[model samples]
Each structure stands twice: as C-alpha cells, then as structure tokens.
Target chain A: MKHQFGDRRRLLQLSIAAIGFASASLALFIFMVTGTALIVVWVGVPVVVETVVKVRWLAELHRRRVGELLGEPIESPYLRRTEGNLLDQVRGLLRDPATWRDTVWLIANGTLGLALACVAVCEAVLDLLFWWLPPGLAMRAYARLSRALLAPSEKSRLALRVEQLTESRAETVDTQAAELRRIERDLHDGAQARLVALGMNLALAEDELARNPGAAKALLSEAREASSNALAELRDLVRGIHPPVLADRGLVGAVQALSLVGPVPVEVHSDLIGRLPAPVESAAYFAVAEGLANAIKHSGAHHMSITLSLENDLLSMVVRDDGTGGADPSRGTGLRGIARRLSAFDGALEVSSPPGGPTELAMVLPCASSLPKTLPSYGTA
Target chain B: MRVVLAEDLALLRDGLIRLLEANDCEVVEAVDNGPSLLRALTTHRPDIAVVDVRLPPTFTDEGLRAAIEARAQVKGLPVLVLSQYVEQLYARELLADRSGGVGYLLKDRVFNVAQFIDAVRQVAAGGTAMDPEVVAQLLTRRSGDKPLASLTPREREVLEAMAEGRSNAAIATRMFVTEKAVSKHTNSIFSKLDLPPSEDDNRRVLAVLAYLNG
Candidate 1:
C-alpha cells in the first residue's frame, strides 16, 4: 500500500515536469511561423536554417522527456551531415524530410501536445488528492503523441536511401571519367609515342641500308629496342585497365598471381566456390590490390595475409599486415580511391589500425552466385 | 626437332614457321584455334609444341588450356607457351605436374632469336625453360621462405638463373663468373635448400622449380 502511494507521488512529479516542457513548444511555434513568413525574402534562408536547427534540438528534448515517461529511449531520425558551405547546408536542411516533420511536430506539440500535458497535470493532482483517476494515463498519451509525430516514417527512410544512392553514383561516374582521361594520357605519352619513334627508326634504317651498312644496322637495332619498349608500356597499360591473369583466373587466382610480384609474401585463404559478377570481382580485386600496395609502402612490418569468403550472398575480403599501425583513409588517396571504387558496387571499406601494431582492412560486397560460362559452345573464329 | 605450332594471328604464325624451319626444326602441323591445336598435338605427337597463350574460338587463354589439356593426355609432352604478358599463376599451373618438359616465355623473348631457339631446344629435350621474368617473380614470392632467406645475394642470383633452366656454364656467361663459381653457388644453394646432389641438369631444374613452387 505504501509502495503504491510512492509510485503515484513520482508520477505526479513527472507530470509537472512534462507541463514545464510544454512552454518551450510555444517558442518553437513562433520560430516556425517567423521563419516560414520570412522565407520569401532573400534574408530568410539563414533564419529558416537556424529555425530548423533549433527545432531539431527541441525535438530531441521532447523525444528524451517522452521516452523517459514511456520507459524507452527514442532514436533520433535526422540524417548525418558533413561540414559544408552555408548554401549547401541550407539546401541540405530543406531537402531533408525530417526537417519538415520537425516543423509539423512543433505545430502539433504547441496545440494538442500542450493540452495533453495540462490534462496530465490535472489528472495527476486529482488522482493524488483522492484516488479517483488512474495515475499517468494522460502522460502515457502525451508520450505516444510525441512518438507518432517524431519517428521516421517509411517514406522518409526511402528518401534517405535514394539520397545515398545519388551520391555514390555521382562519385562513381566522376572516378570513371578521371580514369579514362588518365588512360588517354598514358597512351599518348607512352606507347603511342614509342610506336611513332619505332616507325621513324625503321624508315631511317631502310634509307641507310644501301648507303651505310653500319648505320643501317644501328638504326635497325634501335627500331627493335623501340618496339620492345612500346610493347612493355602497352603491357603495363593493359594490366592497369584489366589484368589478363584476372580474365583467365578468378579473383583468388589473380590475387595469388599479384602476390608473387610484391616484396612481402602474402598468404591467401578463400572459401569462394565459384566466380562472382565481373564488376564485383574487379572492384574487390582492385580494392585488395590497393590494400596490399599500401601495406608494402607504409607498413614497415614484414608479413601480410589476404582472406576472402562468401556467405549468405555477401562477399567479404580482409587484408591484414603486421606493421606500424596508424592508417588514416582521409590522409591518403589510395584508401579513399578504394572506398570510392567499392561504393559503386554498393560495397563498403573498413579500416582498423591502432597505433604501434598490426593493421586490418576489411571490405564487403553483396553479390549473387556465380554464372556458368558457355565455353564449349564458342566455335572457331 | 618436330614442332606443332598454334598461333591465332596469321602473320606471326608464318613468321614463327619460317623461323623454326630456318633453325632446322620441322613444323609437323600448325593450327589456329584451340580445338584444331588439340587435334594437331594428338595427331603429330610433336617433339615440341610451340603454343600461344591466346588463341581463337574464345580468345581468352584458349591456347594455354589446349596445351595443358594435351599435356594431361600425353604425359610430359613438351610445350613452349608464348604470351604478350607473363603470369605467375599460369607458370605455376604449367609446372603443377612437376614435369620437366615445360617452357613459358614472353613474346618479346622471341626478338632474341638465338636465346629463343635455345629455350625451344632445351624444352624439347625435356628440360624446363622459364622466362627470366617468371623466375624473378618466383624468387620474389619465395623471399620469405626460411631457406631462401639463408642464401647470399650471389647465391640468390644463381638460384634465379637455375630456376630459369640455365646451365652452370650459361649462368657463368650471364653473371660474368667462372663455371666453377657458378657450380660452387649451385652446390651451396642445393645444400641450403636440402636437395640431393644430381648430375642431370633437367632434374636439377625440376628440383629447383619444385622447391620454389612448393
């Protein structure tokens, strides 16, 4: 009997605190009104942004208070944002569905939400004075009201997913364009120039054949050397585009071949039974390659290992090295480039490197089962 | 030596045929696609099969596959694979049987005609003739192996030459050392790698390659 009285006293105190929070809702209502009214003018953008920011803070406070009354924490539904310029920040705020929801929440809480708090206080007093009403019923109703207005709807979740896809697609296209330009530059300066020189050397050798046999021999040798150099450059360029070994062998075999070239020995483990999609394979291969290169260049340690596995349609790759373990993706373009490459395939890269020890880089890509190739059906060309 | 050649490009095929004939090797048959090459290999049973890595009908490692398949049927069948590029994976696959009659070289090696013919002859005699590039890659791969780490830098060089199927005299010529020094390095390498002494150069190469591929 005494415990029941103590619970009602605590409920009465919480109801009073809930009524106190209602006063901030009126301030939010005024800000929304002022911000919306001034949005037509040029100076209204910053005001509206500030208004949204305050609304988020107030909504967070309401979520906390309501969550406490309901006995569970409410998750904030706002999308994460990086630092941007004023205009971009404003645009981001306007683009977010959560901001609009917050505005609606502010309006609802100012009117009906305030009334619920008042009714809860009246009920708490009436029940406390003479056990005539159930305790905390109005407060429970207020918590449900806040939750319905504040939680992320399904449409908002879909919008967030679309925004992420748009970002990654734009980045992938930009990276591809840059890669094409680099390839063009490499051909222009490396193989194409070498071939032109080889042709000129051959023509000179022909001219000097009758007049100067020794000069002709020297020119012929130069032509041969030039042709060899051109071939070497083209081989490198082709490897950069898509390694021939990768075409012949799958990802594991290709990575095995790649491991043979670097100074450090890499032990590879795999549970992949068959091939993945070509683009997924390529992306994963390059990401692992980048990891190996980074380990060799930066990690002063001696050993490295690569492991690949496929489980439940998710392909996972992990590259680990025992070296000085301070790797920052933002500081180096290699890791950033890997992240960008993976994002195109809806893959993700994760780095875990504590100071003074081993470093591990993990990546995951969702892919389907291997498709069987029609090798025997291919006839002679 | 009798040879069966498979190359997709007509111009290179003619040049290779002419080069082989001039060097006193008989071209028993020459074909373009993977299936025809397989048929030619089975029919002629040539002393050596000079195959390109990329052939027609698939254009992706068709010739290498056919060569490997033929070797599987006719055990220890000599095959010299040429490719625009070299891959350690293909080298390992060709050597996986631990058979001595295998040669893998870059197409650029053909520009050095004398060395190229020497490799072809060596392979036909049931000896391995790996490209120096592939040898370098194998050496890099085994850098962390404990016994290889015990070798001196000169010994490592000698080991690389040996893995490329070089005779002690050839290694001496290449390294500007006497045959005696090359032999000393080879003996030390064999002892360090724990291989039994052998007189046959092909067996010696097979042992060295088997150790590296291990």
Candidate 2:
C-alpha cells in the first residue's frame, strides 16, 4: 500500500514538472519572436531560476531516497560560492556544472512537456466530442490511450533511479568486503601461519628429545623462540581488531594501560570519569594507542603525556611526546587510521609535530548521549 | 615452597605448573581469573603467587589488581606478575606499597627457565626481582630528576643495578668493574641522592627502590 502511494506521488511530481516546463518554454518562444528585450529580461530570468531550483530539489530528493533505500551514510557537499561583487557571482554561476546541467534538462523538459500537454488536451476533446456515442466505451478508450502513453516513460525513469542506487550500494559493499578480506588475510598470513609453524617445530623437538640430546636442545630452543615470536604477532593482530583492555576498562583505563607499557615515562590525566559509548571509547583508545606507539617508535626523547577530557559535551584527547619531532600523517597508516576512526564518530584529528621537539596528537569525538553519569573506579584491579 | 599460579591460557598454565613442581615448589592452587586468584590465595595461603597481568573476563589488569589485593590481605606473601608487555604503569603500581617482596617480569623471561626460577626464588625470599625493561622505563622517566642527573654514567648504571636489587658484587660483575669500584660508585650514588649510608644490603635496596620507584 505504501509502495503504491509513493508511485502515485512520483507520477504527480512528473506531471507538475511537465506542465511548468511547457509554460516556461512557450513564454520564452513568445518573447523571442516579438523581440521584446524587456519581457525576455523579466520572464526568462525567473523561468530559468525556477527551473534550476526545481532540478536541484529533485537531485536532493534522489540522493535522500538512495540513502534511505540502501541504509548507508552518503554525504554530498554542495558548494555554495558567494562573491563580494555581482559580476563575480554571475561568473561563478556560469562556471558551475549544476547550472549548465539544469539549463539543458529544462530545455529538454520544455519540448516533452509541450508534447504531453497536446496529447492530454486532444484526448479530452475527443472524449467530449464523442459524447453522442456510449459514454463508458469512449471514456474507457481514452483512458487506455493515456495509460499506454505514460507507462513506458514513468517506468524508464523509475528504473533509472533504481539502477543508480544499486550501482552506488554495490560499490560501497564491495569496498567494505574487500577491507574485511584484507584484515583476514593479514591475520592468516602473518600470525596464524607463524603459530602453525611454531607448533610443528615443538612437535619435532619433542620427538628428538631423548635420541639426540644436543640437537634436541637446539631444536627446543628454536621452537621456544618461534613460539614467542608467534605469540607477539598474535597479540598485535588481536590488538588491531580490539584491544582487550579497551573493551574491559573503557578509554581512560586503556590509555593508562598503554602509558604503563611504553619505554618513555608517561603521565596520564583523564576527566572522562564514566564509561562512554563503546564505539566512542574504542576510537579514543586506539587514537591514543597509535599516538603513543608512534611517539615511542619514532621519537627519541623520553617524556610522554596523555590527557582526556570532556569539553562542551565533546570528548577530546591530546597525546604529547617531548621527543625529536616531525611526525607526518601522510607517512604512516597508523595516523591515517586514527583520522578515519575519528571521522566515523563525526570528530576531527589535528596533529602538530614540528621539527626538533614535542609532537602532539589531538582528537575530538562527539560524546554518545548514553554515557554513564559517574566514572568507574579504577586501580590495580 | 607452596605457590599459587594465576594464568588465563590453559597450556601455559599447565606448563608453568609442571615447571614449578619440577623445581621443588608445590602448586597448591591454579586459578585462571582474578577473583578466583584472590580466593585461592586466601584458601591456600601459598608462600608465593605467580600471576599474569591479563586474566579471563576482560583480561586487562585483573591479575594485577588481584595481586595487589592479595598482598594487602596476606602480609609478606610474595607476588610475581608476568606480563606479555613491559608496562611502567604496572611496575609503579606494584612498587607503590613500598614492599620488598614483589616481582614484575615480561612473560618472555619464561623462555629462560633458570633465570625465571631464580627470580621467583628471590621474590619468595622477600627480595624484589624487577625486569630490566621496567628499570629502564623508570630511569627514562626520572631523567628530569636533579638527583638522577647528578650521577655519572657509571654511577647511573650502579643505581640501576641497585634498583634491580643486585648486590654490589653482581653490579661489578655485570659492569666488568672491580668490586671496590662498584662500592665506590654505590657510595657516590648514596651521597648524591642524600640517602644515609646503611650497612644492611636489604635496607640499602629498599632506599634505592624507594627513590627509583618514586
């Protein structure tokens, strides 16, 4: 029932657009033939403006419909160029593709709209003129003709919209699936494979323990080293997915935990006293973790500090390291991931790592409305 | 010696139990999570407890918390925490109580079975066995401290070795210096840090640990 109603509404919209286009074109034709510059200046400009506005409105409608149907977030930024002078504004409008496309669509719509109007009028006239015959038969024939004329065009337009939406969704899903596969491949090839090899080494070492004590000892030592390496790799892989500490203790605890492990001295100050929404906490935790990792790996200086606070309902974190600086977002995937994570939360990441000292990484995330009121107590336990 | 073992992984737990048992220590209780670990300490009253920093059901600092709680409850009951990562935070938390019987080492240390066992023994005997990594982190953090800067490079090494609870002889051996020279460095470190010259090794260790742990 809802679907039928939506179809009917679309049909009404198409009919209105057809009528508006026909009227605008006829007015333009009349002004052109009479060579009335004043009429052209007044009527032509309004008609052109109205047509452009209508097309833009339709485009926005289409975009919103696609978002709703596909259940995905798609942002289209409409560039609104404003200039100080009228001449500059006019130049900007002329350069805009939206304006040109709208003009072209309007000209095409004008021709089709006139043809549609003529058919509608002719059908009505025939029905009235044939009133002397059986009224029901004549009316039914006219209705059939109108339906045949409109069905194909309406169906084509509907199909075009659906096709565009489907193509966009397919692209999104494909990208997401590809990312998942990449992560799975990384784990399987990197850590899981290493662990399997280590296990086999352990088995071989066990068999040779008594028969070849000297060789067995060496094999045992190799197996031990392999196992340790594999364990470290597995830990890294797990951390990439979700650090267990972050999930268990929330963002503050997670950052504190990271500070404890780093080679440099770290001081942590947090005002996020309570548990935040899981996704927000996760992003914040990883952002800080990545920052700390970068500081430790690249920075030569020793002291590091992390601060988390809620400012004006937004969760903000700043990680600073007093080290030889020059950290760049473009140089590493870690900082890029941090940017992406913050963006997902409608947040922003700002980095300031000038040469010769103190690198600072800052991130802000919109706080989830469902955060707990009080901070959870944290200690060794 | 009776010991309680707290580790999440079944295979590692079993292996550690077997190893400790072979070393003539009785494994009185084996618990996989933090709460159970604390409960086991109360019930078993083991002479020592070996814990993993990560434990079941959230796996972040649960074992560390349990170890701290257990120490508070049972006076002089030694605790050793093994962690996959070297975290200066955990080290500081362990040393916060100003106790002499705590140990924190990276889990990788387990591969060197003899040294790991020796550390456990040291902790059980009411002496600290801190990881070199933890000491390094502490020193790095304390680089800004005036007292730390006052020490010469050799004196810094002596202080670090002292913070690890090494004897003057061990420090000399490690640094390849004469024991007399190690003694001189220790005296210089003590004087620079304004610590009273104490004859007792344990007292000297406690004083140094207090300064480093700060």
Highest TM-score scorer: 1
How do the residues A1-381 of candidate 1 rate in per-residue lDDT, one tens digit apiece?
A: 678778788878877776666667778678767876877885766777777787888889888877777778877778765358767888887777888888788777778878988998888878788774567789788889889988877767887778789999999888889999999999999989988998999999999999999999999889888888989899989999988877767688899888877777788999887667677778889999999998888988688999999988789999999999999998988889888888877889999989986999999987764434423322332
lDDT of 2 by residue, A99-175 (tens): 55444434443565466655544444453455443222322332233233322243345544555556555654664
> What interface root-mean-square deviation (Å) does model 2 yield?
6.5
**Model 2 error, position A100 (Å):** 14
Instruction: Supply the global lDDT for candidate 2.
Output: 0.69
- How many collisions between residues are there in candidate 1? 0
Best by lDDT: 1
Give me the displacement of residue A22 in model 1, in angstroms.
Answer: 4.0
Model 2 clash pairs? A260-B87, A260-B88, A260-B89, A261-B87, A273-A375, A274-A375, A380-B65, A381-B65
Error of 1 at B33 (Å): 2.3
Model 1: residues >4 Å from true position, as ranges? A1-21, A35-47, A60-96, A115-144, A369-381, B139-142
User: With candidate 1 superimposed using the best TM-score fit, by how many Å does residue A39's alpha carbon deviate from the native?
Assistant: 5.7
C-alpha local distance difference test of each model? 0.83, 0.69
